[model samples]
Target: MCIVYAIDSDWGWYYFGCSTCNKKVFKVGTNVRTLNGQEITSHIWWCEVCKENVSFVSPRFKLHLVVKDDTGEARLMLLDMVASGLISESATELLNGSFDELEDPDELPEAITQIFGKTFTF
Candidate 1:
């Protein structure tokens, strides 16, 4: 059970965010080359509450993330991280869990509980 957290948006959709910054990317692109030799385009979604950008391909799959030294460097790092083992374990775990739920599109709050096997008494 490797997972960090999730990031939902206002467009009735959601995406997996970085462990450090929980941002959700609405638009996703791929198969492009980056300056760091990462051959993939990332769709970035910015988070208003947290003020960060997240790159996600789909609900169940998240390309590797390239984190940066500074907050402003997120865009560049994200691409590099994709398809590469450059992200933290916690971050990967968290993203995967959230994405799994999105993939189902049928499970709601119950989906989360079912996967994690923890009950949220709300």
Candidate 2:
């Protein structure tokens, strides 16, 4: 069990991952040449490790939390499922909602802010 004292939204808390290999991916645009000598640009989710273009992307969360009890304070990295449970919202929602709004800790969404001062069983 742990109590959440703060959500460190200073860094990006969520990321887009490759659905196939489950690795971090970047949204990128690439130019493609057609057989007819036409050049076309396309946007895709690219995984450098996988070295391929992926159609499906899954949301992943990597959150830094400040949690404490009577003992002392500690910093924790909560990822994916655990992070979802802490905020009572799935990573997909976080991605779709206000993830882009997280330029600063003070700019965190209410969904994340509501987790402050909340306790849960790990």
Candidate 3:
């Protein structure tokens, strides 16, 4: 068993993925078009696996944790499903708005921080 001590929040806690394929999506550019004579620009994300621009993306958990045991300490990565089971809230739920809205992008949410000092078998 290992006890969770700290969370590596430097990279933030989640990644935007294609809603359909559930694969990581990269922001390619902005799509500008005219709708009803009004010009609109929307962010475009490309999913490598999907091989297309995905208009809908969802935030998925990608938590990095620092854990320790008798031997030493090690870093652990918990993806969407595992993290969702441990935390009670989905990444989408915790991130109520776009990433830009966060006061500190590197800060961990209260729910995720609660794992600190808890022991679990990897």
The best candidate by TM-score is: 3
Q: Each prediction's TM-score against the native?
A: 0.27, 0.72, 0.83
Per-residue lDDT tens digits for candidate 3, residues 45-84, read: 9999989988898889988999999999999899898888
- CA-only RMSD, every prediction: 15.0, 4.9, 2.7
8-111 per-residue lDDT for model 2 (tens digits): 77666777778888788887755565767877554477898899987577778878888898888888888776777667677787667432334454566577
Best first by lDDT, ranked: 3, 2, 1
Task: Give the 10-residue window scoring lowest on summed lDDT in candidate 2.
Answer: 97-106
Residue pairs with backbone atoms closer than 3 Å in model 3 (clashes): none
Off by over 4 Å in 1: 1-31, 34-38, 49-101, 107-111, 114-122
| Total clashes for model 1 | 10
Q: How does each model score on lDDT?
A: 0.35, 0.73, 0.85
Error of 3 at 43 (Å): 3.3
Order the candidates by TM-score, highest first — what do you get?
Answer: 3, 2, 1
